[model samples]
Target: MRRTITKFGSLAAVSMFALALAQPAQAVQAAGATGTTAASSSAFFEFTDGTDTFVFKLTDSAKIQQARNILSGVETENVGVMGKVVKTPAWYNSPWKYQIAPNSVSFFGMAMEVCDASISYVDTHLNEVGGALLPGSTWCPWQSKLTREVTAP
Candidate 1:
């Protein structure tokens, strides 16, 4: 029994060594990662709902402009990337909302209306950004996405 146990241990060591040699270098770097990824300042919004925060990373100029328009209440139509639906899900021609599984979300609007209207307020203020109907809101500071591509030595 002792001899069999020793042999099995040796075989396990050899298999581990072989597996390590066959693995890609990327896995090693990732495992040894001492760095982290960051967000960019190219134009992104930080949304908050008291409990959680959402970061919308805007890249495309048109989409960014659409977001701007939506915020400004001058957007022609609410379609595709122009909707106020802020979920970090990249689908269709737009990126997804960057929130962490937000459910029971409420938009800013008036009473007696199925959907409240931040539109009227946005139309006047244009640069106004808050969610009265949606409890609380906050403008997050600039942040960067971490780029942790490491060089394995």
Candidate 2:
């Protein structure tokens, strides 16, 4: 059961979305200019599906700020492109060995993680992520939101 997704307004209305997906390399460089290592500058974002809280890391300074803005109510874009879920050590505080593609972070008004599929479906079908589940390896939790900014462990 998919709900009706809302479309974002013109470009002027969602400037943060554009900024979030901006050049990540440039953002890392900007952080370096300010005396911070790429890893030290990484920001953590927390999203919730009402029952569960998911944490993610954004290495891009621009995306970090954009995520902070979204959580602070400055940006209304509540959806993000989750990219690929890596089978590495969990970047977030989850027991599952999954982490979203940091370089692929971006905001969207409406997105389907794997063409109208739910996150649970993807998790249950993680083995087929890059194959059938998420052919392109992107997971956009449509109902997810930037609930908070957290400190990395």
C-alpha local distance difference test of each model: 0.37, 0.68
Give the Å shift of residue 153 in candidate 1. 32
54-97: candidate 2 lDDT, tens digit per residue: 67778877888788778777888655546567756564657555
Model 2 pairs whose backbones collide: none
lDDT of 1: 0.37
Candidate 2 least-lDDT 10 residues: 1-10
User: Candidate 2's error at 118, in angstroms?
Assistant: 4.0
Candidate 1 lDDT tens digits, 1-153: 999999999999999998888675665466558552121123554343333333444544454455566555675344211124332343321222322222222222222332222322323332333444322322212221111111211
| Number of residue pairs clashing in candidate 2, backbone atoms closer than 3 angstroms, sequence gap of 3 or more or interchain | 0
Q: Please report, as a residue range, the 10-residue window in candidate 1 with the lowest summed lDDT.
A: 144-153
